[model samples]
Target: MKRSNAKIISTTFIILLSIFCFFKSTPVKADSLTAKYSMDIELNGAKKTLAGKENVSVHNSSGADLKELVFHLYPDLYNKRETMPFSYTNTKNVPLTEEEKGDISIEKVLINGEDTKFTEDNEILKINLEKNLKKNDNVNVSIQFSLKIPKGTSRLSYFNDVYSLADWYPVLSIYDLKENRWDETKFYPIGESNYSDVSEYDINIKVPKDFVVVSTGKEKEISSTDNKKVINLTAKNARDFIIMISPYFKCISKEIDGIKVNSYYLSTDDKSLVDIAQSVLDASVNAMKFFSQQFGKYPYDEFDIVESYYEGGAMEYPELIQMPKYVTSIEIQTPSTKRYIDAKPSIIQGAIHELCHQWWYVTVGNNEYKEPFLDESFATFFTAYYFEKCEGQYSPNAVLRSLRYSFSKLAEINPKILNLPCAGSSVDKFGNDKTSYVQAIYVRAPLILEDLRKMVGQDSFLKIMQTYFKEYKFKNSSIEGFLNIIEKQAGSKIRDYIGDEIYSGEYKAENLKPTDEEINQIKHETLKEKIKASEQANGSVLGSLLLRVENGEKAIIVKPSSLTKEEEAFVNSKLKSYFGNSYNKLSIQSDNSVTENELKNSNIVLIGNPWNNKIFSLMANNIPLSINKTRVFAQSFSENSDSVSGIFSAKNPKNDQNIMLAIFWTKDVSTDFYFDTYANPESIMIESQFILSIDNKRIETGKF
Candidate 1:
């Protein structure tokens, strides 16, 4: 009995020692665990076809015991024709999952040392573990799978110049925060994580020989035999992986800070085809050179560019960037029939943007699934920045001009931040809504960062940014964390903006519209009030403000002789509109002409004018008072008038940029024009300033 007790105590001590060791070695993470991975992908001819296998290693960093493993098979699994009764329910952008994900049968699933039941639920394939893993314990799930790339997915990938398939298969899902703990209640809406994702990914692929493959990670090694050649790769702690294979590839290599650029293109019919690569090479070199000078250095070797067919666009892999055929060829026989000659900027732009991903998306990783704006915005900003710095001052403007095609789309919508699922989990809900992931991210994040730059000035802003890059260089962090560092560096300016993010809540507002009722009310109110308040004794101040007409305003009488040539011409030219097609009348009422002395007797108020807000007292001798939350009107006016001031409290005034305001004025007998003055900020506030220059045609605004 004593011996048995001794053995038990010894075993318990050993287990406790192991536990202590683990706790000491684990890195600290918040609300979730940090998982590290090493994946090996190689093309093998053993199956006489391309085969893929994954040896995923995971660590349970949190308090919860992970029970199951879920894999996201994002490929266009099972496509069905548009059917009658179109229920149209696709949760993760995958509507036909059961039928599509049904084909691949998991041949084996082993947890610890035993077999388990791994099932498929639409695009989600999972293994329900036989036993729950304890805290700090690790698990490895080995999966061997083969895919028959489906037809017509808009999905594409290149296989040794012969097969270019995209969206062909369901790659493994990424568990960024919590491992497989997601709510299917809503598809990923947009921005930030609702829960957490935790899982390690290690993929192994085997393709045929005579192919140069561009993929998601740096090349580890190449092992070859007479029958086939294989390349082994290991991408650790990354969100997704892509491998492009082509046999028609011509390899051209260059070195930037020892970071290798392996550009792939088709060996063209002409000998000058060489420059295609040389151009791409130059772009790669110049982009890296410019970016490193501006931001930091490139961290990886073995970047690749290969021939593409789908829209001739480029998708960047970690070490390799893929190129389309025409994108690289130097042949430019015609305007329409062009190659690298026409695609120089895109070739460069795509290369620069993708390469920037090394820092933005890949290095300073954020919740891309949550706030993709965090990623794409930086890319967009940098894309323009690179163009301007590399080419010329105005070059990026042209590049940015193309992006502005969507500005009206942006202006029409309010930014919506919906809690989304883990990356790769919610494939359905993600799309380019005018404020979609890419656009919203591309627009707002940079806007905010640019605002930041303006706020702290360039030098301090760059200092803060440099610190950000150095701190979060290769780790995953939250956007809040970024804001925290900025707040620490720039102080309360950024803090208030960030604190207001959730405080503002989420409002999905449609574009502004001026209703008939609203417009009619403005017209009725203006006529009634002005006819009563005219200090000219001609009935009201607006009476003198008006050009001249009868009580009913059937006609407008203008004193062209009493006005200056500029004023008469302005009045005459502006009068045609109201009298041209409408029932308004004009008369030559010499007394109705506005005079400096008459202004002292009446109160003239122009709706929707900041200048009106500025000199309200000067407006026919009215007391000037300013306050917020006041309702105002905008007017359409005629030409050639002296001036007046407006009275209203602006939220944030532009101190540096001139505060310009526009208003439209229309009189009972005729429409007229006037000018006014508004306050310019004296520089000290960091907020949005609205001049409220009501675009007289269709103006509708409200209090924020």
Candidate 2:
């Protein structure tokens, strides 16, 4: 699932009291125990219900007498608003209407062809065995159940003509023989909480003929009539089965390296939306191809990316993923315009992030409730690797820089947050504070892997991952088990190094900081890339000038030594709004004291009358627009008025290749004509030269 930035209600008091009682359970090897499910369900769209009969065949090979069976009824979490684990305060603290509540009811349960008594409580279903079945014993359990699909946005809900079904079935819970207990972790409101052993599934669904269904496995057979359709799907060695149905879904498919990749989206007549769907399909294909080669091969032959209405970002299943429709449905508002921004970059990043889960959480399973970082942190790190190698939009260095900057800002509010342990932490450890959970698991945990990568070198780190994946495929792994693999591949000292950080979370915060030289290098590379892209598109010079300043290029704002208080205030306010905390980096030099070298080396912003500003006077001939005390002149047009104002960009005479000279001159120095017109410099085109009147009207505009 994509991490949400939304804040959650604090449960610090509850957490502190329960923190000492947390214990780790030892994993039990139950390879001999196999579960195969055959389910037949019918969906009633009007009633928002799914009535199904499930026949499960369980084979016990644990060499121990089985006394009882346990299953997780995840949908029960939504039976009442109080038990739901929504991170947002509105959902967590408020009551949900009856129509917005979801739940599952087991009407009947039969074991070995006999009616059996069962108990259900707190999302757990247990059936006491009538007889102690010896090793190699097999039992067939038949369950009749009905699910009330809620009218809201969630993993299991009906919203906007879409039904997303995840964790909606009575899944046999993983039992630890060593601990002599079932893994009965409740559904968490934030992050993932489902954990199960790999099982085979043969599912049959009957829905309205118009509804299109996308699920975890391949569609093996289909039969439909005039009003209804029944689809048969099969999945082998899958951790869980998920299904999504919508009447308006349209599918586009492509074959990548022998794997058939399908993208299911809401049908739309808009060409732009169709294009976005295609981009999502392409990104999924690219991610699958890249991860297949890097990690182990994707065992499944079919993959699906289904767009649905789910608020929790994107979710991953066995061979399928659920993407939020808003990824392509929303429009963003910028300072200059409200337009549908290109969502391809976001699609790529999000798609890759979920696709990496196939390897971390699906093929190589882990106990998410006990050790979420095992899957989430690895998926995050691998997603970075995919971007760094396949896509340049988010390189590893850039991701690290952004993470460090975000953590530093959070530290500003509470420095102790830096000491929160993440590696061995469980979902319950953080209680209801989803923000802190994300910081520790998603942000800090990945950095620990990155530190290990830097310590052991890239080659050994890759080997360690490949070995871990190969060893733990189709089984649940623990953090200590992963560290043991690391020790086997690398040295014991390397294992201890990571173990200390994981257990104590006491790494030096200074390590997160990038040195000044590294910062400069990043800025230099960014400026070069922006310049190249702008030149390729024949963009405006004004755009390139702003890009240089934003990338940390030296910039100075020159004003006349003599200025009215109003003019000074205007300059200071605009500067403060534009630069925020970084305003100190930009020097406001008086025209009298500005040096010749500064004018030549820096991206100069001359903001006064051309006659009074020395920097503007020096470059008046080289600039595209000619400004005077009462008039502004461009190459094609001239505006002569007391309120005439203009802004333009030109190559610096001394350093044409690297430096830019931009001037914002006005006839009325006290007026904020320039700032008002160029509030969002990025919206301006490159090489732009414009003249405007004080009434906020454009008199003349052209490119240099």
Candidate 3:
């Protein structure tokens, strides 16, 4: 009887488990906004024209009924010279030529298989729906349009037999719940203007059979029929799509952790440049791996980096990246900065920059119109992060070094930007000055992120970034979204810190010296002076003299001196930064090797003091001030000069067109007086670590 009871109990338990399994197997619905697009396009490369037919399926997730649909016609903004956002002829920015202009025309629009009325404005396309679509309803719209690709270098253009297509379709705009309408932000030239919803795409492109296509989304298939190549692609949960096509493309690819990375470059005979491009591709693969560990996994199965003709260094899209062909050209040269040399992988810093965008922008989407910094700032920060952590370019103290450089320069050039918060300022805050806007978004914003890291600690900060990526992936995020998640992770209100670093418009700048405007004014005046002095001079060879001191065993002697390795490296870096591409123009020589004729006709740069090189002794009395082994005494100029390390500049006695900059030190001080203040004839005395003494009357102080 006891055995029979045990069997019945076991059967009852099994029946209960079966009931739980049935309910658990039921599917749960996922809540998200959905828009599906199907497109067919024909490329006419010879005429630089594109004809496309699109069918869009839209779902009304907004609670209220929608009577109209809004779209962005981006191609219209690039057609005319008056409406064009930017030009790339030179720094002064030349206007587009006739052949370089572009335009777009809508042939027809259909809603629910019926004719629909639509109006086109500058980058704005609004369609009136005949029927009022209720909430949770679906509607289909068909658009037939044609685009004239311009012969220019921009996001969308055809240049050097390369065609780049960005925002080429009539994409639906996001619904602003608070505004109760679609976002109507117009196109702006300085940054990206399109704000879109995550959508699915099915694209079919037909081009000449010889053309090679590199584009966003997964390649499904390619077939050749009737001397034309037909390519099909599909993408899900993407904010934008871009494509590049060229008949001369030479393709190479590699896979990293299941993610395929393809690099497409124009076929070239220069093996050196080709090797450089390959190395850049390799760097990008490493960037992807580093970003995935820092933030989160990169969701896409493949990433593409294509070399094309664009004015900018590079531009990033969902899964595709466009870079200027010059980056891989044989003529391309890198800046001789310490950061560039130590981190050799950053030779393709542009590629690393765009790869980071794949995670920050494509994966964790943001409204580029409302918050440009959200994408640009993070991309820049990670670029530096790639240098410091991934590429091993930066030393442990490099962050502090970069911070000092960025802050000092920003404070000097435009103190106003220091007042604006990185997270709170709008693109319009910079007004027409694109330089300040770039500095604020790229440089200042990254420093703000670094400050946050310091406040919350490294582990906590990593957790915050990962959490943000997980929560906002495939969705649009705002500054509020970021701060909220960060605060939750830190277990405290960061309002004060956020306000001080990102929102507040107040700053203290007493610690910094030599404003950028002051420095620039001096540079301009000096260049002008050089021009005036050269009006009747023999030739345009305004040269420079380099001198160094090497203490010998027996006695101090004058001889031709070659720089040590460390000295050569530092001088090269400084020369490149100070003179840019024109560094080679400066003539270099030793103190003893310099001819008397050369001294009379060229600018002189003395590396050591009068006590060591003896050349400065000839110009000593002519200088406004003098210093001894113990103290700084003045002949005609006066200021506090105790513990001074003398770096003086004066007019050459023989030629007014020439000048002399003496980097000197007294016997008592060991502080290496290294600075880029050669533009002014003023003497800079470093009394202490950060103290600077500038005699007003000596440099004609107010003139700058």
Candidate 4:
């Protein structure tokens, strides 16, 4: 790997820029809890490593004489072991080579200026005290370590001049008086890997002059020598501190409601992505304000959203969020690749979701290893609310559609997950199955939240969030504690939703009911089907519509176009054979050429994603099924690059008398091969069972 001239120049320019951007530091409040950390680190960019020193002071607030202190060395979980938390994989989805594996060498540890012996087990560092420290006594511990950075998708890794430093430092574990020990939870790669007390931090980082730093706190100072830049940052009452460094980044800053919001991205030689990130930052700012009013006022003075590489789309830190670079790297005008790259929606969703964590997980801290739903559930639901209510941008119909799709996916993957409680399940219960954990914590938990909202009412639900936030801000919250608050707010609560469903792992949606609209839709469809059957029996012409699309775009029929020899044979022979002259006349039309009159009179068929068909794109949510052009996602399955093929039916928007059948396929599928599954009887049977629901409230999806 070689450095470019532009990289060198950018480094120099950033060091110079930091000097002008530094702000004066503010003194810490005297009466606050006295856990504080001061650190200095130098990034070995060329070696993909970090050499650091840390000093942490913690008061023994557990009310018991402390014999030892515990810290979670998260980055060291990358060691080659059977139970290691992470499996380093490359873009090609293969495990990394030995040299790329991450490891941390603890060079020295000192307690009150004396060298101390420490024990390491399963990525945890436990230091013994020579004598028991009395309750309320404070201890200062110092550490020196070298971290070998891995090159892969990681929460803390370096690749291609970009460094994602999350949980890279040794963090003190929370002390649980009830357990009479520190809460030293093992690392679970699927969900949160670290849990710690909210503490103050003063960190000074020295990186190569050009490497721009995006971190968790307010910048206090910046200085530069010839080749290195030193930056000082401070975070007050934050659960964790993170630092992201990249020389390729272009940074933007804005002030929103007294908080400084910063957005950083890798320059793509195009400003479109940067513009998108700016808009996302704005949306996040608005979300933060909405959450503040609805929950509690955010305690932080600054927030940063930085583009980084990770296994997940984005990760939430205290004041810093690592937004997956995939969101900003998308080609705007025309999507370069289909699936997971839809810039606008994904960016907004990620931005709001992560910012919501600033309140739920950061402020109202929770034991993520014990009760992930406390954070993930609220973050997800708030993301929905931001889109549906707070922002007033996404239509209610769209929100419902997306949620219903998620529910269906959960049902498809494992209906048992819907029955299992999300609240009390241990992080280890999810194991390394990221997909199931997400469906349980992110998807199903939100649905449960919505159920509670519907049961209590909107006003009460909003207050519940506010009460919970205010009650537990800057403290550890539990499922039991949250339940007590919401129950008190509701007044007439019996079976606790969180306790019964999430914690006990025995939650079944109770008394599922279909809405009035759903019942009417079913009735309307039944009557329409009777009329169509009667007309067919009386030898009347049965009008039908057939739409053919190519790739995900609408293909026009300006002139007679051709498909492959196999495609022509399937369409003319096999496809016609399956229908067996069911339609009196099949009206064939292109996505670009479909007429309203045809939609009004005939049974219509659409054969592509909404991206290609204007009609489908506009009415997708209005119809029985919804689609995002970038990806076809289901609970059990998701195909990136828009490669999934499915046949679905929904009522034609132009006319109740007409029927529209959509046959969608990915670009890679052969014309003849795409519809092969639709021809299967099992596929049809599964499609027929379209009793859709929202928040476990069943809805009658109209027949196509």
Best by TM-score: 2
Better of 1 and 4 by TM-score: 4
For residues 19-104, what per-residue lDDT tens digits would candidate 3 score against the true structure?
33222222222245557887777787656788777777788876778889988888887766545555454333556666877777
- lDDT of each residue in 446-527, candidate 1, tens digit only: 4455455556787887777677777777666666777777888878767676445422323111122224564444343334
| lDDT per residue (tens digit) for residues 39-154 in model 4 | 77777776677777777777777779989888888877776433344434433344557756787777777776667899877678899899887777777777777788877667
Q: Estimate each model's TM-score.
A: 0.55, 0.75, 0.67, 0.68
- Between prediction 3 and prediction 4, the one with superior TM-score is 4
TM-score, cand. 1: 0.55
Cα lDDT, all candidates: 0.44, 0.73, 0.65, 0.64
For model 1, the run of ten residues with the poorest summed lDDT: 678-687
From the highest TM-score down, the ranking of the candidates is 2, 4, 3, 1
Q: Which ten residues in a row have the lowest lDDT in candidate 2?
A: 17-26
Model 3 CA deviation exceeding 4 Å by range: 1-33, 82-95, 327-347, 391-398, 401-404, 420-422, 507-704
Identify the runs in model 2 with alpha carbons over 4 angstroms from their true place: 1-33, 85-90, 327-342, 392-398, 408-414, 521-541, 545-629, 632-646, 649-704
- Against the correct fold, how does model 2 do in TM-score? 0.75
| Whole-structure CA lDDT of model 4 | 0.64
